[model samples]
Target: MTFLQALWHYPFLQIVMLAGLASAVASGVVGPLVVSRRLAFMAGGIAHSVLGGLGIAHWLGAPPLLGALLAAVASALLIAFASLRIRENEDMLIGALWAVGMAVGIIALAQAPGYSVNLMSYLLGSLLMATRDQVMLMLGLNALMLGLLWLSYRPLAATLFDPEFAALRGVPTGLLYACFLIVVALAVVVLVHTVGLVMVMALVTLPAATARLGTARLPAMMLAACGAALLAVSVGLATAYAGDLPAGATIVLCAALLYLAGLLIRHLMERRRRRSA
Candidate 1:
């Protein structure tokens, strides 16, 4: 009842709830495509790579969010170019970018004079610190991603699942791939605040991973992931509030538990099917 009252009474809490749900939707939709295309590591690289931009921003006394956006987009484009076109030691290149970016961020932080802001907040995240402006920004970004995905669903699905066939069918695979990377970069920016840079990849990947265990089709997988993400975010938010826990870590842990449960259920179902056969 106290929880219900707090939600019912507070406007800021409502905004936080809205933000959490919106973030989940963004992750749910993007995660499967990422996992399907085996770009999970690349996404992780992008996530960590943003820290370099943030550190640079702090050192220069500029807005870190803007810096993060530019840095992440740059990293995403570079990886997209190397992996898609060069096709030589692609993973190694991304790995190098990841390490270098993180190192740059740490160095920037260490050198910054009289830095008072807690880096933990950027790394672990706290939903209670969410502002109305940030929530609105996430809502806008989510709408943009969904709209773009809807407009290009056919070609995008083709590019995701079967790029060779898509190209053969006149899908302009190269252009679509670049556009997809742009969308991914934007999504990462929106998600970083929700789960922080360190744990953001888990939020992006876990729900979709659990959904993948049940469905093979892209559309079905996305819907299942949305459901899983919503439940995790809602439960985690409530649990964190009651226990005075870290919101970002709590949400991610909840999602991880769901993935494990999904894996267990999938294993059992497979065994049952084999026995019936």
Candidate 2:
């Protein structure tokens, strides 16, 4: 059957498509900031740190997304603050925070009875299990994130390139940075349900990285990244359904392959340029 036919026949497939699209949108929107700020490692740290929130949610009988969002924002603030103090060893600080967060999460999970199953789902991701409510929540989060990015694009762009210059021009660089962290935290929350904490960075980085190879302009890169993310998620979801593989892993692997293809194209473009010159 055709892709559309399969999608039409299966409610679960429809849920998966919606989930993947929302995930792609969130990832694409936040990815450029992560890339430009040289905060990929920090982003990874925040992603892993979300386990602490998941554990707390399980213990309190609250929504895991809320807990994760709270924990992620706290973690982002901590990291941002620590970077100011430990500029030379920022990675070390982030790594330390990441370890501490995961340890706390695991301990909390152990303390809560019957949480092992829920923890496992958070670890591996279960897009197939997303309910209509969860899908709507994802869509809402994406809308908020994308809207914030659009409204703050100019200052954000200035800050990303040179905070000092942006500040000289009257942009509140510090405030913008703080806002960026909040946005990243929200993106992490949206991503954790679909890609989980472990593989979440793959979704955020791979598409942006692929797009970067083809374009130097930030606007073009963002658009390319969004397109690449959508393509990756759609193709990956389809492959997972056909091959019985894990959805999150399939999506990440597909993105990695696309990144490789982009690299090859970039290399060819460069070689052609050199030959013509």
Candidate 3:
């Protein structure tokens, strides 16, 4: 069957596509700020930390996503506090949190009955298993993310670019910084279902990084990133379905290829410009 035929005949593919697209847009929305503020490592830390919450939640027979959210938020706040006030090596603190969170999650999952059934999906993503409820949740969360960014664009941008200047101008830099980390945490969760916890970092950062090569404006970069993510998700999903490959890995690989291609194009363009000069 052709790709279009498969998409038309299989309802799950439709759901998967919707979920991937929603998650892609969410990543695009927060990605620029994450890149600008150099929070990719922090984002990765939060993404890894979520597994602990998921495992514990499963053990407790609660909603796993809720557990992931709690873990992500708690880690984000802790990272923020330590970075702002602890006078310690920030990477060490984040690394410690990352390791501890993963250890706790693994221990929790070990005790949970039937943990193996869905473990792969949580770790590596299961886009082919996307359900309507998940797609709905992603859409709702994506909308909320866009709303929050819209409301706080100016102060958030100012705080991200220059915290000291923003603080001097009464922009509540510390509060905004903390709040932004929370936003990043939320974004990571939104992406977990699309790229899984293991590959969330790539999807979250690659689109924005690729967009950065072509534009410096935040708005333009966001639009370009969204477009790039959408293309990657679409192409990857189609390719995965056609080839019977792992959807999350395929999507991430496609995004990574796009980034590399963008880098090559940028380098060539720069060299040409230099030669002309």
> What are the TM-scores, per candidate, against the unseen true structure?
0.91, 0.92, 0.94
- Per residue, candidate 3 scores C-alpha lDDT tens digits across 147-244 of 87888889989988888899899898778888888888888888987888889989989999999999999999999999889989998998998899
**Residue lDDT tens for model 1, 57-91:** 88888877777778888987887788678875767
Best by TM-score: 3
Model 1 residue 7 CA deviation in Å? 1.6
Using TM-score, rank the candidates from best to worst.
3, 2, 1
List the RMSD of every prediction in angstroms: 2.0, 2.0, 1.6
Which pairs of residues have clashing backbones in candidate 2? none
Clashing pairs in 1: none
Q: What is the RMSD, in Å, between candidate 1 and the native fold over all Cα?
A: 2.0
Ranking by lDDT: 3, 1, 2
Backbone clash tally for model 1?
A: 0
Give one digit per residue, the lDDT tens place, for model 2 in 80-197: 6765545536788779868987888888888986626566678878887888888888888888888878889899889878889999999987677767877888888888888788
For model 2, give the 10-residue run with minimal summed lDDT. Answer: 79-88
lDDT of 2: 0.83
In lDDT terms, which candidate is top?
3
